[model samples]
Target chain A: MSSFAPPVQRLITELGRLPGIGGRTAQRLAFHLLRASEEDALALAEAIKEVKARIGLCEVCFNLSDGPRCRICSDERRDAGLVCVVEEPSDIIPIERTHEFHGRYHVLGGALSPIDGIDPEDLRIAELYTRVTPPADAPQDEHPTPIREVVLATNPTTTGEATALHIAAHLREQAPQVTVTRLASGLPVGADLEYADELTLGRALSGRRALS
Target chain B: MSSFAPPVQRLITELGRLPGIGGRTAQRLAFHLLRASEEDALALAEAIKEVKARIGLCEVCFNLSDGPRCRICSDERRDAGLVCVVEEPSDIIPIERTHEFHGRYHVLGGALSPIDGIDPEDLRIAELYTRVTPPADAPQDEHPTPIREVVLATNPTTTGEATALHIAAHLREQAPQVTVTRLASGLPVGADLEYADELTLGRALSGRRALS
Candidate 1:
């Protein structure tokens, strides 16, 4: 028989299902909740329920949202003509933290990985194309401000690179007027040159900029 | 304004309150939950609620239990006369895993820490004494099997040492017939002598037994 009671074992099982949590961590967390005040423990439970009940994907950008559209999609202040495409909703936060992108975002849901069975059709790539391209029935002037540029801000991983290239090629054929760009790849700031990986060093050498 | 919606922010805040979880980890967990299926997410929330609602301290030994008495306390086969005293309910798991002790346990709830205002009164030390010492009003034959021995299985920390010493003194005065002992302090089973700390090495030397 298990040392812990049924309920404790159940809680540990559920907590262990989380992405990074292991069995020991789940046990520790369960014990902590048991020791915590009723109000505090219930707060964590209520928060989990509330997030699940209220949060959904944005209709337009596919970013996580509390309503039909995400905050960025609803905001008129952000540049609608410039779209930064990322692999997931979580990717938008870091870019937002920088205050570097004044434009909206397009969450692909996930990157392409053939070995993992994730393909172009599996992602929200078609939805992205539709968002960028105007309808055939609509007049040229009907949509005054068309998407001018697309910044592929997918992760620098192999899958992210493949997904970005696939989308960029499709966008070129679908919307010839739109400009496609990729985020700069080089050694990170504050990094020692000696410790830089061969691939990163090569990218840094090839993409080196001239002194102003 | 917060970058995330109210529910997402609330979840992150609650997760951040957990031990070792920081803001970034909290955010990562919140995002992971958001991405998870509704059933999977609800299971975690329900688990938290169930653990809080169903689990309570064992009435007899003070270990976490789903009922009045914990598993160890309820077991007839275990040695009730031999008690192992620990600081918290969490400590019981490791001892149970070792399978070296067949004795029942007494959870003190916490250790003695004068700086933190924790004293004998704050713990279940008095309850332990009550369990060890039979009532004066009871006849000798009324309680056939009296407590015979107590093993102070508290941590090796300063507070734990003080708590064990205090309990030993009280047990000696109140129930002189019972044998009281503390867990030995020394180098761990699989440790190397070169990396051993001075205090631990000294304890190993002092506690060494004669080679047969």
Candidate 2:
């Protein structure tokens, strides 16, 4: 029989289910919670419950939100005409941190992976197309600023690349007026050339610019 | 302002309070929980709440328990006369895993650290004394078997060493009939002599047993 009580064992099992958490780490976390004050322990439980109860996908872009729309989508200052498409809601954080993109975002939910059974239909691709190209019967006054540009900010992986190309091709056929662009893939900033991979080096050479 | 919604941010903050969980890890965990099914997320929250509500300190040894006494304390098969003293209840796990100890345990909560202001009074030292040496008026018939041996199994750190010596001196004066011993400190099994520290090497030589 296990040394710990049933409740402790249950807590350990639950914690072990989290991403990257091993059995030893789960035990350590359980003991920490046990040592923590009742208020502190309850606060963690309340936070988990609250996040699940309140947070939902944004109606417009499918990013995580507490209400019908995400904070970025609700903000009047952000440019709705320009949208950055990413694989997941978490990807938006890094782009926002840079302060370079003043436009809004559309979360694809996940990238396309045929081997894993994830396809364009499985993601929010259809929803994205609807946002980019509204029906002709819709009032133009309501959407005064038409979608001008779409920047594909998906990851540099094979599936991410495939998804971006697929979306770009679809947008070209459906909404020819909108410009579709992919994030530049080249050598990472401040990286040593000796350690740079062949693929990244090849891209850097092709995308090289003349410094005037 | 943070990119995440208020509830998402709150969950991240709460998860960050756990030991070894940094800001990035907390954010990852929060996002994972957000993506998880309601049943899975709520199960974790419920488990945390249940552990806190149901588990408490064992009345006898101060180990974590769901009832008045710990499992080891309640087990009639365990040796009542032989007690293994440890700094924390967590320490008992490894010893139990070894299957070398059939005796009950006494959890001291923590070792004496003068620098950290942790003294004997702060721990369960008084309770241990009571268990070892009952009052003179206590009926002999009620206690069928008197405590015969105490194994000090605290860590080999400076504070642990000091606490063990302090307890050993006290027990010697209080109960001359009881045999007080300490866990041996030497080179660990399967450890290389060349890699061993000077102090540990010296202890191994001094405490070396005669070959059979």
Candidate 3:
């Protein structure tokens, strides 16, 4: 009704919803798609649908996966006794790229932000304890080996800190024989791990500290 | 192989195919979707498919439309004597928002870019000329009113300027009785009308001048 034909308006609206795409950019993008070949426009659409339908959460580590477990979780080379806990699946990539830590991962799904109502109960913290200290028989496997160390790689943000503390405390109680560590302190405080440079994340992983 | 899971990499490669979304941003957005709620992620996928499936070019004006004729072209109340010609459908939105031009529109689809191999034949120029010189029986019920003026609202870019000039020359030769005018010069040179502030665009519109 605001002058644009409904179809034109709808394309713009959807494009604007994407991150960093503004109204003007969205309009430009919509027009570009309109002007492009039908095959190209349909290609973008198919890509979006294919990614959503085919990809899923890794059963063991909760990372994005196309099958039963993420590539890292399925790999025989990664250390079974070492698992790094982080806030989101995206955080796992930079660490994995470094090739510095040949260990598995545990995606918490999100961090502990009480104000945001994200408590330990909301995250996969209980799952971490369960994975590290399995109840003798997990029904799926004989026994989840007594994990030797769990490096808390959650972002250095406020919520990340709280989640790390909660995990550190819980792991100490549940898996007393296991060591719980936090990624090193040099990460720019309050920044998300996704934005950190490879060198910094690598250093943090290599120089991790034991939780007191 | 390069640190990303195959599906994640595939999704990133596909997302990078969009205009403006690059490799790093594609990776970031792909991961964002991985963590996003299934409904929200699928909504984005559905929106992409829906827009492409439902929208098509308006046969009358060549603008994006849900039906045969564009909404503006189909409207009975529009001033048929006044037709605004623009390089793209997105241009229609700003002019429509002004409320100053009650005229319908003809989207040229693109400008005359000889360097890019886009010529008058590639655009809706012939159709515009035909619109200017109406059908023989067009006004059998009412007094025949030849199109009074064509407001060329193409962007201020080099190609846009050339396109406007080309159309003006054609209209002068084909429809001698019709007056041709380009949207005014106050529009910033080399800038797109889509990004022009409404006030500036409206002013340029109100102060439009006849092309010699």
Top candidate by lDDT:
2
Docking class of 2: high
lDDT tens per residue, model 3, B14-55:
778778888878888887776667777766666666667777
TM-score to native of every candidate shown: 0.96, 0.97, 0.83
* Chain B TM-score, one value per candidate, order as shown: 0.95, 0.95, 0.81
Q: Per-residue lDDT tens digits of candidate 2, residues A1-212? A: 46789999999999999999999899899999999999999999999999999999999899999999999988889999999999999999989999999998999999999999999899999988988988788787656667899999999899999999999999999999999999998999999999999999998999898999
- Spell out the clash pairs found in candidate 2: none
Question: Candidate 1 versus the native: TM-score?
Answer: 0.96
User: Residue A34 in candidate 3 has what lDDT?
Assistant: 72
Q: Candidate 2, residues B1-212: lDDT per residue as tens digits? A: 46789989989999999999999999899999999999999999999999999999998789899999998888889998999999988888888999999988899999999899998999999989888987778788644567899999999989899999999999999989999999999999999999999999998899889999
lDDT of 1 by residue, B101-130 (tens): 998999999999999999789999988987
Model 3 off-target regions past 4 Å? A139-145, A187-212, B1-5, B135-145, B187-212
Contacts from the true interface found in each model, as a fraction, amount to: 0.83, 0.88, 0.53
Rank all candidate structures by their DockQ, best first, as comma-separated numbers. Answer: 2, 1, 3
Give stretches of model 1 more than 4 Å off. Answer: A138-144, B137-144
Model 3 error, position A28 (Å): 3.0
